[model samples]
Target: MRPRSRHRVDELLRELATWEPKELRELQAALGGLQTALERESSKTARQPSPGHIEEKYIQRGNKRHGPYLYLRYWEAGKLRSKYLGKKPE
Candidate 1:
């Protein structure tokens, strides 16, 4: 990665490092909720062949007015899907 990109990642890491215990717990709970929702949704639909793999990813959304927020990304049936996680607590 370029220096700028590395620096940006470092900055994000630093920001994450400053999160409070409560905030971390909130994020964890959100993740659990997401997992449950996925499971329920999948169960409601007919089973399909696995797309070889499934991945959970974090994505950053940039908005000039609202700053940035993180989202959860995943794949189902060879298609990409995402859900809004939450904004970093102030």
Candidate 2:
């Protein structure tokens, strides 16, 4: 990997070490859910769209517009979709 990519990987590893047990569990559950969804989609007889992709983003909500919370963005049926991941850590 390039130096920049290596540095980012190391930084992410360090950040992961700081996560609380609950946070880690949430991440694990999210990944497991993704896996299950993939498996279910594969078993369906109906033609499915090409495998979608995911990206991290921040989304805003509420009347006061009180966010920019972390989110997972992807494509489904050629439409963009997102799932909230919670607020960005300080």
Best lDDT among the predictions, by candidate number:
2
List of clashing residue pairs for candidate 2: none
Per-candidate TM-scores read: 0.33, 0.36
lDDT of residue 75 for candidate 2 = 46
Which regions of candidate 1 fall more than 4 Å away from where they truly are?
1-15, 45-90
The 10-residue segment of model 2 with minimum total lDDT is 47-56
Candidate lDDT values, in order: 0.56, 0.59
Q: How far is candidate 1 from the true structure (C-alpha RMSD, Å)?
A: 13.3
**Where is model 1 poorest over a 10-residue stretch in terms of lDDT?**
49-58
lDDT of 2 by residue, 30-77 (tens): 565455446655676554443332334544555455545655544443
Report the number of clashing residue pairs per model: 0, 0
Tell me which residue pairs clash in candidate 1. Answer: none
Q: Which tens-of-lDDT digit does each residue in 19-41 have in candidate 1?
A: 99887755555555467556755
